[model samples]
Target: MRRGGDWKRGTVERPVGAPVFDPTDERGEETERATSASPRLSSTLLQRGKSDAADAEAICEAASRPKLRKNFVPIKSPEQQGAQMLARVRNQFIGRRTQLANSIRGYAAEFSFTAPRGLSRLQQLLIDIRDDTTVPNLAKELVEALAIELARVHDQIAKLDKKLMQLHRSNEMSRRLAAIPGVGPIGATLLSIKVVDARGFKSARNFAAWLGLTPKNHSTAGKNRLGVITRAGDGMLRTVLVAGATAVIADMRRRGSRPWSWLKDMIARKPPKLVAIALANKLARIAWKLMVSGERYRPASAVPMPTPT
Candidate 1:
């Protein structure tokens, strides 16, 4: 016998002509029919089986998730770290040395013992004050302590400088950057480390932006406005660039060359500070291009001129 157009079960199956009960028949009957007819519903059973298999597979995969591997870049070696640490310590010492000298000078000024304003004059001033009978014993003691601290600071800086020079000799990248004018040992070392991948930037403009040398923008509606530099990148690098630019500017002036006519024009028109910052921005861009291209810096005249119209 057959039921719902198929044969099933050991008991006599209901005939196809037998009264077909609606699924929405009395609650108990519907439930009984649904339970009894479940196995006969081959399509639904297969679908449910497939769903269970899929869920089990998903759970197993989740439970056995692959271990994640760390991909951290290699850290600096112990020697490099040591060198950097020494350099930092030396910088701090130099700062302390300056502070000590300044404090002594201030103290001397209070006693009408004015010393010339410069580090070179510091030792002489200290000596003069120490030898003077007019200075109180307490003041002399303070001066002596400051002098000792200054000497210690100088010693530390000197030691660090020697270590830095050794490192610079071993570092080819540092040496290459150092070849650039106005970039000394400190500048070269810092630039090499700070700019790990010069090619990370696509263009010189992008490099300049990375160094926060790009002009800031403010726009509303269809109008656009440009202002000072964004100052959004490595502050230390930016500072070094400014110092380098200032040195370059001074050197150009001494040589009777208008190296950065744009800066000179800006200085004539705008504030000195603005002109300085602009020059720094130009310097940073120039440095970026030089590093990325592995090219030597050439003055404007040395650079090939475009074909004239």
Candidate 2:
């Protein structure tokens, strides 16, 4: 109805087909539900993405890692680590033994009693000195002290030997390697430990190079000059190899067998030290081939003869 020319108020109405709930109240409810679910969804998605990425990266890294030929294998085992430790211990004992022997000799020389050259002979001399009434009391006391020190070093060496023997029995490779000529318990144990894997080397030459057996080079202007072995690898192994070679060469000479022709010539031309080093290098190469091929040592004659030239 109109009153004094004023129009009547129209009715308030919502949009057609809209929900019947209050707009402000419905919006608040929807926001609360979304806020609660958002964190969990995001976290789940992030974790899934991270895992997938990590898997892909791992696969790629593995593919990128360096690999040898198909037949090559890497040494990766606790047994190898154990073998290395034993070698180190044995080497240490040997060094200590040498030091003690030298010290005993030097100490005895102060009293005008020259110690014998050999270890066993030196020990006997020390005992005789201790028992001799002719020696002054002060000299006798000093000799006794040196003897005690020598005994202590020997005990340590004995313990190391026991440990090495135990390892030799436990390790199949060590036992087999010991069967090779010139490779005693110490050599076998050290070799087994020091050589992590045969597969790491492509050939026998490569293995010998690792032991620093290959000749060193210093060449210029197309003139090739060679020097002594680099001696780059395990010092203990190198020392053992040299000592073994010296023994072999000595035995060969004693037996009057044809010495390695080169060695024979060198003995005639060079000093004893140089010849020993040369033989050591040859021995190292021989050892590498034997170990790599799992073959036994054969004398030159045992090898088949070449056809007539």
Candidate 3:
């Protein structure tokens, strides 16, 4: 089934008693692009009685539809899949490191040892735990174990970071994407690999919407209501984009000069988090344009230079 049309959109069927669900649902294990049941192509076919033949027929029915052409996901090469695996492993290691650090912090706090926030402060707390005579020896040993595990995780993450950076340096498209203000090596590389075919998206807005950066639609007759982001795509990708945007805004604030007038005005009027999401959405759209048009980023004109005093 995979050989001729693995990328084709098709229907998913579960046991007869099971309730139907969207294959592209955000809560599914990983994003639906690779592991999808091929929903949008045929989510509306909820025929309940499901045998293997019935499922195949349903899939065939969906694939036969002309509209399914618009809904297909890109078929990733082996190289792209490998890059995704690396990103995922690195993400897992980073998360484990955070978990270990938090556990160490909580344990040390119980024994009246504390350090200010920040991962760097964790090492100092670990040293304090090792040297403290008043704390129970058993607890000290346990905390030391956690600290050691955390250090190992940190080293692994560093290794993965180095490898990902090398990949970024080697890819022309990734390098082009890195030119965006918020997107760095990691973000650029991720976008490059995950979105292998830019034309799969209808437009830049569609690309941003696919990433779930857009507001949820709650429109009624003669009225418009927007809610939080749909948050409907690969969670990691969205997180990377948002984090990059936050760093950009933070730096702009620290330096006391907005790079663009619209950003300055928005920051003045909107909440910082909301501004970050907006900026992230813009970044996704810009990335899509770069991928689709094969054009390098052309930054918008900056705030006018101050006249010489």
TM-score of each: 0.64, 0.65, 0.84
Lowest lDDT block of 10, candidate 1: 66-75
Which residue pairs show backbone clashes in model 2? none
lDDT of 3 by residue, 1-309 (tens): 233323334334333333322223333332333322355444466478757675666666776676665455555656777888798898999999999989998988898989999999988888888888898889988887888888899999999999999899999999999998889889999888777688888899988988999999899997999999999877888999999999999998899764566677788999999999999998898898889888888764212433333
* Model 2 alpha-carbon drift over 4 Å, by segment: 1-76, 132-138, 258-272, 300-309
As for candidate 3, its clashing pairs are none
Task: Write model 2 residue lDDT over 115-182, tens digit each, in one string.
Answer: 55778888677877787787799978876777787788788878878887888788776776665545
What's the lDDT for candidate 2? 0.62
Best by TM-score: 3
- For residue 227, model 2's alpha carbon misses the true position, in angstroms, by 1.6
Instruction: Output the TM-score of candidate 2.
Output: 0.65
Q: How many backbone clashes does candidate 3 have?
A: 0
Number of clashing pairs, model 1?
Answer: 0
Task: Name the candidate, 2 or 3, with the larger TM-score value.
Answer: 3
Between the candidate structures 1 and 3, which one is better when assessed by lDDT? 3
* lDDT (Cα, 0-100) at 262 in candidate 1: 58
lDDT of model 3 at residue 162?
96
